[model samples]
Target: MTGRENRRGRSRCREPQQSNHDVCVVPEEVSAHEGKPLYVLVALWCLKRGGWVNRGQIADAFGISERSATFQLTYLSRKKEQICCELRKVKRAGVPVESYEVRVTEVSPEAGVRKVSEKQREAVKTIQRGRVGNADGDVRELTRNIWNSLQRGRKA
Candidate 1:
């Protein structure tokens, strides 16, 4: 047996685990000048994670401060032309402030235009076709009669 192998009972191939060392190091923060588009993209990324993605995860992923994340999210909320996203503050122990969780809702790419789904269109058509009737017919007839009487009175 070699002198080194004899001296130590265990093999030297085994080494202590270095779990504390990060496999990848992310930067500290994102540049501030890029504006709100960055926030929208970040929000989308968070939502794509398949569940309620909180603000801290967003901040960590983007290498930004929580305050920056909040500001970006708030800006995203105000942009009428952008995708609709929801943010709710979550309260938990050891967190300095209530962190936000982002949920994406379906919205039209072009804002301020009527964008109704097929189901909604069918519902409207059904209503117009009298599948749904006004329970108070007397009230409706009275309003029509009042308009006719006014037209007659105007002629008289």
Candidate 2:
């Protein structure tokens, strides 16, 4: 099946990565689809809030159906280990069915992406905005440089 068709029916993504104010850039071979950008944005928004976000909230925010929201959230939960997020069902008074919530976890170290502090996040954004290197350069080196600088500051 073609990539678009595959994505319209699929409910998962490759090793998911999250950044600020930009689209995800997974390898094309394992890429999920164009909608991944939405998912990443929503997930990051939820992360910044420092609280669980429900399916209804995500649906309303993205203007998608609850089912579709669930799919997007499920895709993220599937990569929870990589993304440091988890899904939980919360009970509401007088509601027969429980709704889902996404919560960021503290286990980001073992995950694919390291836990980024607010200061570090801002620093990375500043460095990225001032970037002058090859656009296609590996971001790992950039992350490493930032990390080294942060470590040195801590040591001094």
Candidate 3:
């Protein structure tokens, strides 16, 4: 298949390298499609939310169906070469469904091109879960300490 067709069908691309100044200069081969700018923008939007986003969200925002939203997300996550994002089913209310997140490793090559990775995909999920859990744990501990202090004051 042609390169663009290959990307559309969800193929991988070469990993990009960081420049001396630490900016990522993604090679041109990353995103093969010319119409992926909107996809990348939406992906970034989802990533910034730092949580699960369903197909419905994309459809409502972009005026498309769940399937088309999925297709676009899949194409960007799987097919586009340079940008790396993660999509997985996180259990919510006992239903298995798709949600997405991304790590901003670089500026997109263009508005119509997005580059992402399979390796970092798993990392994205783990990192987000870990961050949230850690924050929750901290809050719980702080609350317990405060309660303990209040009890001591009452005794005094």
Best by lDDT: 2
Highest TM-score: give the candidate number: 2
Sort by TM-score, best first.
Answer: 2, 1, 3
**Residue by residue across 70-97, what tens digits does model 1's lDDT show?**
6767766776566677767888898686
TM, every model: 0.40, 0.43, 0.38
Question: Cα miss at 96, model 1 (Å)?
Answer: 7.3
Candidate structures ordered by lDDT, highest first: 2, 1, 3
Q: Give the Å error, residue 58, model 1.
A: 0.8
Clashing pairs in model 2, backbone N/Cα/C closer than 3 A? none
**Model with the higher lDDT, candidate 1 or 3:** 1
Poorest stretch of ten by lDDT in candidate 2 = 20-29
Question: Candidate 1: which pairs clash?
Answer: none
Evaluate model 2: give its TM-score.
0.43
lDDT of 2 by residue, 1-156 (tens): 123222334332323234323222232322333343555655665666678888777765544667777887886787755567878888899999888888855433243334679999898777756567664556868877899999999999
lDDT of each: 0.54, 0.60, 0.51
After superposing candidate 3, which stretches have Cα over 4 Å from the reference? 1-36, 48-50, 94-107, 111-156
